[model samples]
Target: MTKVQFRTAEERDRAQWADKFTAVAEGNLYRDKNSPFPIHEYFKLGLLGKEVRMLELNAGAALVDHMVADALTELNISSETEGNADEIKDWHKSIFYQDTLEQTARSFFSCGYAAQQVVRDIDPDTNENTYTIITLNSKTWYPTVPTFKYQEIREGRVVSIFSENNDGVKSWYAFVERHTKGNVEHELYKLENGNDLEGTKLKIKDLDRFKELEDSVATDLNHIPIFQIDMTRGAGKYFGQSIFAKIWGNLQEISEIKTQMRMERIKHFRSLLAAPAQSLQRAQRVDDGEALPNNSKQARVEQYEHQATFDLRQEIMAVPPGAQMPQFIQRDLEIITKAMEMIRDCLSEIASVTGCPRSVFNLDEKGTIHVETEKKKDRKYVQRITQCQKKLEWITEQGAKTYFQWKGDKAGKKEITAELDSAFEMTLEEKVDLYRKMNSDGKFISQEEAVRNLFPDMTEEERTEMLQKIQDEDKSLAGSFGDPVPVEL
Candidate 1:
């Protein structure tokens, strides 16, 4: 029998809150009126929301690796499976623990920076809102996108307080411990002033320490240490566990994806490097000059018949009757023989017989083949040779537009393009041609909006009919955009 675990009161409360969040997301409060969609996939966004999801995934992967290592050293495998476990371990390392550590730093400030564009509700250059949100790709370094604040978030109690163990809570101090390669105690041994935290109390560290820790963490930005250093609060706070946790979580996710991509690139490069070695072996075998296998029982007979034909064409045709038909010449005979041999070889490859030879053919001593061009008379020499011209319709127009005119000439080869639209009377061919030319690139202009740059000519109703026809009534589709219909857990 299988056992099932039920949700506790706390779990139930969390689930209910999630349900409400999803309900609110269905409304278009976050989006413009033109779109009907709400936020997507909120149910599985985790505790910190989608933006901070990297932390959870990173912590999860680390926990999994540690668990597997524990299981292996503790003999957690079956005897029936004889394969080595190193393969599994190596695979894990490649998937999680590789990186190219890059040292780069950036500072974010609410106030305008020296080099940054002066943004306001409207930027003078683009006429966009001043203080328009800026998003950079950060190709050189991992990108950190800050979400704009809207509401207040609750600050939860800190479970493990560091103030009791350390004299002061400093950024550099936290980082020295965070990136220390071993367990907490092992890291403390190598770290400076690890024991100094025992008696002092200065959570009010200076600006230099804060800046130093920030830059230190940024040093090996590729491989981020997270999950273990989860902040008490999540985001939208001053320098606290919440902010660091948010940063750590995002870095962990980026590292995970980069590791996967690097593995693929390495494998591809290895295979490409082996191509030359494979080609060399094939070349060496051919350099020895082994003769290709051939048999000549059928081919030899064809050669003899070819030679006889050549001799007959040259020696016999030079004189009148038997006088012109002299004895076969050896050189002429050899030429005819080569032609027959060539034809026979082709037949042998296909495993078939050649067509029967009806007449002798040979090159003359003057290197010319004879043709009967002198035997023509004057009457009906060449009946007025009438060439059959395949007439095809070619219709060109003022290429195309949202509107077009279909014109065709009476004597024109084209019966097509008589009408631009179906409402216009046109033959099926004409309509097809017009549509083909216009639609070749699969684009069309529709009667959309031509903005009212100036005022309208006449007065009209306060609200246009287009407004009434639009969906003003909010539909309870899946979620809500505005405040949700609250339901207590």
Candidate 2:
């Protein structure tokens, strides 16, 4: 008999939530053939007892992607101070912070939380320290219960564990990385059996298989190197709640309705010919008074039915004398129309829950979205995005600080800051028009100020160079036109 280890409540809950949200985010709701959900009916469709592909309306993916795109569009990260700003920008580019930032946001929105580990190493060519950010799989990474003060989470520790399975090996290895303030720990253990339970407490028998593969190692960094982003925080909750959880019911309803409509179409779209049995039998008889054998009569009736069906596909068909004409059954489309209406309603609810506009998901059948209404609803979403932006900014600053700390650059560490653009802000054209109008009215201080307003991401050095280039261009144009004619006042 094989002994089984059960998962702890915390682990079980996290696993369930992660699986549910992941399925929705990845549009795999019906991947499980035995799923009890109504959406599974979509995948159960069969022709001649063989299952066929079914329609899937993945509203969850649409919602998550739309919000994430809105939040992270035109994202710009930079140092807040002039000190080492250029170096920090270069570091961001070297580490591909933009891509990492988008990945982190996607994970956070889809999985309720995201974790990243900062790795510091030496560059082989320059022998200088290098820093890179690595996004961790939410399922493989666990955070300890956070320290709380006055009903708020102050800090938390993280542990990243993954299993390594070697080919042709019965047993596997587990690698664990633990991060805490001022120290990082690494451990490797070999499991005698492959049944070591993950995200659960170990039993005595399970512990017996845990053989140390190497001595434990610890690194002191004076700061926690793992950065985490949580979608929403609640009191005493270790992990945040996924957005999918709130809108899952609506998504499932939409998918089920879509599946139902698809099934209806498959069943009703074909032209079904209806005729009296007598007509078919009469058409099969060679002569009106000819008496055929029972077996032959049945066979002739079936053959005549098949022929009639095939003939119905043509523009005209000839029927036997005294035989009734077959009439085509009309399909009722009211059910499909109602299903579409229900889907639109569910989309509206999802939009409200997600703090996004219904237009994003094409829920508006009128093809027009109310701008003011959308903007009003988007305010709360914008605030949420701003909060996430701040967290990402903090993460970037922390990573830069860690890099500088490893390099022994105390000033750089102290001066590093990160900035991100608000996705909901005014458009570039709108800003340009406003600035141009202000400058025309003499409300502006100088051209530099206008330039700063237009391009806030540019460094002071870059701004100076840009202004000089403009001035040199103006001088060249003036020279090209020759000296201006002197006019007496």
Q: Give the candidate number with the greatest lDDT.
A: 2
Q: Where is the poorest 10-residue window by lDDT in model 2?
A: 149-158
Q: Residues 1-489, candidate 1, lDDT per residue (tens digit)?
A: 222222134433332332222222222112322221222334235432334321111222222222122112111111122432333234224433111000000101100000111112335698753221122111111111124433222111111112223467442222122222221110111112322222222222333333322222221111112111011223663211211122333323333343334444444444421112212221123223544335666556644554433221221222333232222222223434554454333322211111111111122223344343222211111110000000000011111100011122223222212111111234445534444443456442111110110112322342343333333443433336565777899
Q: Give all candidates' CA lDDT scores.
A: 0.23, 0.64
TM-score of 2: 0.67
Best candidate per TM-score, number? 2
Q: Summarize candidate 2's per-residue lDDT along 1-489 as a digit string, tens digits.
A: 343332245764575567567667767776553231343432456542355454466888887777677667554444555657687778778888788888777778888888777886668799986788887767666555555522332233333333544585454544455556565555444444423544233422343334432233334466567776786767776677787867878887888788778777876877588765444432333454655566687769856665654333444445667777878786788999898878877888887887876767764545333343344335556555655665676677777777777667644545665656656556788656645654686533357766765788898999999999988998899897897768899
State the TM-score for model 1.
0.14
